[model samples]
Target: MRDLIKDAIADLKKGDGFIYVTADGSKIDLHDAASKGIAVTPVNPKNQVIKKLEAAGLHLNDGKFLNELNELISLVTGNGVTSKTSKRRTFSDAEKSKIVEEWKKVEAAGKKTKAAFAREIGVGYQTFINWLRG
Candidate 1:
């Protein structure tokens, strides 16, 4: 609960860009598994920073702490997150054509996958695929 944020900060600073399984509590930090929640909300690993966060409690936030959480979430999840947010982003037809054309070069190079490219362009795989549908 407490050490979570600092551990996350450390994890973020490492920026290895991979989140591992936390259920076993081995070889992975909470933020490392930020999958969607951007939370390591399970481990109560007795981190000193967590203890400090508890001691300096705001007493207003029910239970959640960290004004820095938002920044942390963005860093952890950012555009690389696997899931999409609720809102739909509309792209122009020209933009769609451009993306599809670029993907052609990437596909020809065989160095990357459609999914990876879609992530790079900040679009979902399905959305990217739909552009190629026609």
Candidate 2:
């Protein structure tokens, strides 16, 4: 929701970012909560985020930005994943060729650039170019 984005940005502008809004319409003062509690574990925001989205008229099945909303929430709350995976993603030669073929087909249709196509397929632009080169 645009409201959510604006709210998140406004919270950023507020500086310290102690306030967090949850799906239940509850506002949390993070520092206060942590101070009062013995310990705190980050709550998974998936369900709550979706609930908020639904309340704002966006749904999981029909025309929604679930991943983007989650990302924005993570950034606003400073709860984004900070660790990288030990293993890197790899695709086989056949997969690379298949992706390149699809890219070519899209290009032939004059629809999008390698970067746009890469984003559409959720891969890095450089990786898509490497696939195209082969």
User: Over the stretch 1-134, how does candidate 1's per-residue lDDT look in tens digits?
Assistant: 55655664665455445444444445456554564454333433334334544566622222123324444576788843433343467999998999899899879989788887887676888888888996
Clashes of 1: 3
lDDT digits (tens) for residues 8-126 of candidate 2:
44644655534454455466666765676634344435445556656876665331254565666877899856333323568888988888887777789997777767766667788
In model 2, pairs of residues that clash are none
lDDT of 2: 0.63
- How much does each candidate deviate from the true structure in C-alpha RMSD? 16.1, 16.0
Q: In candidate 2, how many Å is residue 125 off?
A: 1.1
Measured with C-alpha atoms, the lDDT of residue 123 in candidate 2 is 73
